[model samples]
Target: MTLTTSGPSSSSAPVAEEDGRRVRRRRHSRYLLAPFVFTVGTAVLFGLFFLWPGVLGLSYSLTDFRGWGDLEFVGLANYLELFQDSEFYQSLGRTFVYAVFSVPVGYVLALAMAVALTSKGARGKTPARIIFFMPWLVSPIIAGVIWRWMFGESFGFVNYIIQLLGGEAVPWASNADLSLFVAVLASAWGGAAFNMLLFIAAISNVPQSYYEAAELDGANGWERFWYITLPSIAPTSVLVILLSSLGSMKEFAMIQALNGGGPGTQNRLVVQYIYETGFERSLVGYAAAASMVLLVILMVIAIIQLRISKRNNAW
Candidate 1:
């Protein structure tokens, strides 16, 4: 705390040192203050968009409010009505079925493709990503429309190609079994590129030391994955699965364009049923309630995913 002074027989050197220390302390406090302010602001902004809607949805699900006045009190009535709605039950069943089919398929395909693309540091990485990722870049509505042509019953590309090979033209989006299957297939086709980008980016960062060590130890391909690659990218795999399931649940454009939830609701999903209820029949409250249920299911899955991943600490 040494400080020289020029004043004759007088020096406020110690005072100056104390004052300088105080100034430094104040500057440090100012630095700390900024992050505190920013954090609070960020929290509020997020609450407004993400948390606020969920709160409103929850409130509406329990009441008769539909973004309208009065907010009439009706406890759990909307949920009860959902139970009695046959179409809702059917749609929900189909939504889960779709999730079951698309979740593993989309994520696995993405991982495999990403691994291969990055394996040799493929020179085609850019084009491959651009090509595969193109589907995700396309507007959902546009993709749905294009896919509809490709799978159209009579003159669609799939049928036309089959005819070219002396095969039967199957209605990809018409038959019940085929509709759901094709919808799941379409999801995998459209969604793989998105997951691939994420997976590839994640796996690319994995340390090569692990692989080199495994190879040096004479580990087989399966053993290396069991001990190395899977461990390296497990977190990404979990994230992809979660996102794929969420997307499948909320899917609309493709389903709407493909068969309009037909063959008579055979492939109708819960989200479509919500659309029909809210905009089609003006049951806004019911639609909101149904959406809340879907949100709950997603939240539960997210919680489970996070918990399992954290517990495993596999990445």
Candidate 2:
């Protein structure tokens, strides 16, 4: 009788343990299911939109293909042509110039605006921020149009004001020298708002205690800002600079709408040149090659920026 009771108890204990394991496994499966689905969905989207198109573009770059039809492999002919193209080089140089002229100037302006607007003594901060940020909300094409109107030679508001002040009507878009300058100025005007907001947020997050401590140490406003404020927002500044540089590098819509790379290609950025090549001239393969070159340059810049950010622990 004792032996029989012991056997039943041992068997029951084994069954209970098996049931507990089954329940745990079921719970783990439920927890993993949602993440697995999400991961698969994200991978599929990335492949469809970005990875697949990039691979196809790379393959097409090595060919003599127009937009469509039979493809013939040309084996670096397009790259060779690109290397010999003076217009392409000129456009690339112009893009670099725009990035250089606009990005830093825009960053400084944004930082200044952020500091001014965030100060405790500032009046109508919200309205000021909204007005400053309005240009960014407008479409690039529209902004270009607005600027084009403002900078018009004969009947423009700028010319009207100049006439009032007895200054000459500056030919902003028509003049080759000033056209590039105008384009860069418009880009900076529109772009500064985004960086301003970023700086405002970053500046706001800096602890008030730091400023108070600096004050206690007999630090002047300039010294406090140079040491504590600048160092605190260094990471945000780097991020803003990187993004602004990238945007400036690929400037197209505003340039297109403002000058259309006109005054004899004076304002032509690389993207606009590529667009005209690929769509207008029906030189898809050549454009693709140029695009690949630009892409590589951008990738290198991005890698360098990432390395800098990592070194600074900005991630």
How does each model score on TM-score? 0.84, 0.87
Instruction: Estimate the lDDT of model 1.
Output: 0.83
Pick the lDDT winner: 2
lDDT of 1 by residue, 78-171 (tens): 9988989888888999889889988888877888888778875568777877887788777766777787888888879989989999999896
Q: Which ten residues in a row have the lowest lDDT in candidate 1?
A: 60-69
What tens-digit string does per-residue lDDT give for candidate 2 at 121-227?
89999899999999889899998898888887877788899989998888876887688888878998999998999999999999999999999999988898899
lDDT for 252 (candidate 2): 93
What C-alpha lDDT do the candidate models reach, one value each?
Answer: 0.83, 0.89
Clashing pairs in 1: none
